[model samples]
Target: MTLTDRLVRWRYRLVPDHVLGELLSKRWMDNAIPLIILVAVAAVFGSLIPGFYGPQSLSDLARQWGEFALIVLALTIVMAAGGIDLSVGSTFALGNIVALALIGVAGLPVWAVVVLTMACGAAVGLVNGLLVGYLRLRAFLTTLVTLIIVRAVVDMLLLRYAVAIAASFPDSDLWFWFGDGFVAGIPVSVVVAVAVALILHLVLSRTRPGWQVLAVGGSRRSAHNVGIPVRRVICMTYVVSGTLAAGAGVLFASRLGAAGSDIGLGLEIAALTAAVLGGNSLGGGRSSAAKAVIGSLIVMILVNGLVRLGVTSGANSLLLGLVLLIAVAIDVRWLKNRNKVLAKVYVSPTYADLPPAPGTDDGSPYALNDRLRPVEAIGLGEIDGPEDVILDEDDNIYVGNRTGDIVRFLAPDYSRHEVFAHVGGRPLGMALARDGALLVCIGGMGLYRIGQDRTVERLTDETNRSLFSIIDDSRLRLADDLDIAPDGRVFFSEATVRYEMHEWPVDCLESRGNGRIICYDPNSRTTRTVLRNLVFPNGICMTHDGQSFLFAETWACRVSRYWFDGPRKGQVEPIIPDLPGYPDNINRASDGTYWLALVGMRTPAFDLALRMPGFRRRMARRVAPDEWMFPNINTGCVLRFDETGRVIETFWDRKGDNHPMITSMREHKGHLYIGGISNNRIGRLKLEGADPGWTGWQSYWGRA
Candidate 1:
């Protein structure tokens, strides 16, 4: 192992997983760390230098920082929107020159000069915007060219009228006061810069346009696909940059009382440096205007402290460049490996090791024998990954496929299959409502209803998220299975909040309590959490007595019953615990028993990994996804349990030739329909001596 790897491993071993996980999971930590570093640097400097924090020194720092602060703000806007404005330095100088020319050459009023100068700045921005946005020119190259052209133009203008403008505008008192005047003990420029920062911060964070800018910056192609007017948003950012740059220029002229050619010579680099230091990414789509101000403060402090410490200007430049390089390197690395890093620190809950499974021929109730008689392969190659199978009143079979479609086979022969509805998500457990609408629990989405006409409507996608989540948790992440109660209330199990539906194995690895059971009431049109902090709650089944429902926590290898009626109402109790496999879907059978589909038989290696949380966390990080040791989903069996949770029967495909990884099974009309998440075909088995006329719909609605 590399030295760095060994050190990181050692550090992790020494620290508790929860402490590291919580600290690393916080979103604000990235921004807060830089601010903290800045404070620490300031403390070191303050202790070394006298009067560093005094009012006079502070006032001087604020006064000098105002114009540069405005320039930094401009850079931040353009950078956040995935573009850069290298012409800002030239634009600032041009604005001041325009103001000076309007006042001195045309003899215009101060207000007219200010208005014309700003217009000139906007005109420059318009050119840049058109070139970069409409003409599809590269931002960096186009702005670089504009920077040179504007600077040359400003230089020529200054050369010709240098003597005349300065001589004519000698006694411009209002202009001088605008740059240097104080309002309530603060410089006017400082006040203006601060006000602009606050306003822009609000706009960027709280407004749609600001979000559009970020969206475009994150990915221009994605923004275009989503119809976000990518070009317009990009163009607007340049215009704002130009406008702010002009304001900074006016302040620059006022503060210095001269429109010097070198006034904005290195302002662009300074602004870019400050923005980068403040946590703005060069690649775009991430920034905070408030953090830009903090970055600017850091830059100013660094420069001022170097000067006070008798450091040369050359050394100061070198130090700033070095800091920028280091910060960018760290930021890029963090961005690339954030997920891996998080996985390493994730604190998974410890689980007890499962016992060895009984032999297939042992004759135990949970034994894996050849009880599942495969009769036919329905939709063999046409449908893929039919995780759940169901039946309607006519014995028309329905199965939700992986391609976000609910496929239905006609009754009698079950030969003709067609798409019943396109739910646009991975549909799992489904139930029929009293009004004939098909209620489905869509993975990654929420509960949805398919009308008799096959029109899909979203029922509910949100519940009270845990307050401890780092990201917004209102939206459902993995709504896995659902079952409807007698009173028309729909209960669903959200598999895991930490991982998406496809990343179910990650939940198994984490073994954390990130799952919950939620209920949606049709009359109230609302969804609320009924149980919280479960470990991969997968399948759900309502009881025949209509008093309680059973839910399977896959990672925990247990089934829990939540009673809402009778003496046990408002209580939750474990009905089935410590199973030999990870259960997927549970459904009511025709013979007053529940059929549980064991998705995967647990192995000793995986169970041992579950008990060792530290090993799982490290494995999640160090191992590639394909190489990760997931639950043994390649082989599975079906188990029948009574109301008291006693194992009554077992069914297995020992060789997995016809059906494997059985996730769900439904019993109807003397036939047992079975489906798997990884299998290409649905299996049918003849149930000998079973009720030939019994249907799943009649079992629920009683021949309605």
Candidate 2:
């Protein structure tokens, strides 16, 4: 390989994947980058320009910052709610004109004038809201039209009465103080702007209205389905936008002692630029008001510095336009390739090469066999990716589907099926509680309970996060498979904390210890980590004697035993090592043994890739997701193991015609029901010698 390849390989060996993944996945990283840029810009200008950091320049900046900053805050709220108000500049100018007219000609009190001016602005906002929210008009187009109409009306009013208003109100100390007064060295307008920004920040981050706004922005259909008043939320955002813009206008007019037609010109572009620079998404949902303020400060500083340098207004506009374009391009590209970028930065673990697989000869345990009888396909096209299968006391088969549903197949012929529960997340492993309640591990959501009445309740979704972790580790990301202990404790395995459920292949490539085994006590309603730092822990099963449990670590291709009562209690020991294929779920066999399902067999190419950590990391970043080397899950086998962990017998669909990628198998009433992660329907095999009445429930809980 080239020198660059060699250097990357050496670097990969020096760092761990989990550590790198944790650093890249931090939430603060988004805001931190822009904050750093702001600081750098400020420092460069402060050192290069004379009087840039002086008190006089700072005070003037504070006073001027309020006008545009308020407008920026207005745009931020609307943007967060998945809408934009292009009419803000026009509303600001109109507010100025109305304030002048009411005070100069109408001879109204300052307080009454302020209220009337604000009311007019609110009226314009109400119209915009009605069009966008209730009338279903496009926000951008509707607001653009409003901008034209409001500007036109403001121009007409100015043409008719501007000279009279200007002559009537030549001096008003009270009004000027609203813009020029200072408290604790901060201008009154600056204080108002800061307070408003703070309040908006709190509302968006902590209040119900803010959540409703974000929810609507995130997905309007979803918000409506969840019973949120989508229209009302959208309407309220525009109202806030117009009111804030109007307040900015009053401040601007007061500071200048005149209401000019061009006073609010180009203010919209500045506000939008500031919001975008602060990391506010144009597509909406994920933004903060605090970011807008910081963005506004950056814009103000840049403009002030440019003016000090005697840059032409045209050049200033060009520079601002370039900044906006570059910032947006960077933000969009980073968001699109965030996962790939993260993969490039991290070092995945490398594994020892896989040994040669045993031939499928007559003497081999995995020899070609047709002992697994084919059954009619049930829910053939209806179910998707039944990763794990279970049965209720009445022999009703329950399968977890890829579309976040738990489907139940009726007994006898297993023809009739219906959706049992909609978990809203990919459901993986499932178990039957002693009380007949169903416990399910929803991939991204966490552990949940489904009662017979069809009520779904979340059991637990958090564990004690590692103190050293920068990201919040409390939330489970990929809860894979679960099994219950006799003493009312529920045990489950989180496949990979570093990646989500859909990114299982990426986790395999990483081959790092990002998985953990957790136990939840129903009596105490507590969940705690029992074992940690496992490599893609997949399936879990409690031992028959209630003394230990078997957990399959997929990437490691090994099964481990954790004892609860024996001398090895609190310690883990390998039960089976160096498996030919990656194991998935473990189920109790009827004859006092266990059945282990191998999801995929390791291939030579994947084995070599595992040994080269740097190669895998590069592949993850450069290769398309579908083209990435994944575990060979197209062919698998189920092996029966004795209590001593010795292989008893193996059953395989050698050609993978009837069933492939067998992830889980459970014996009930002499029929072995098999499930696969990518199969449309489950497979059933008849075991002639096995007890026809034996069930997995009896194997665990015994006959009542």
* Per-residue C-alpha lDDT of model 1 across residues 192-217, encoded as one tens digit per residue: 89999998888878999988988988
Q: Tell me, by lDDT, which candidate is best.
A: 2
lDDT of 1: 0.83
Best by TM-score: 1
Kindly report which residue pairs in candidate 1 clash with one another. none
What is model 1's C-alpha RMSD?
5.3
**TM-score to true structure, per model:** 0.83, 0.77
lDDT of 2 by residue, 475-527 (tens): 99988889999898999999988777777887888787779999888899998
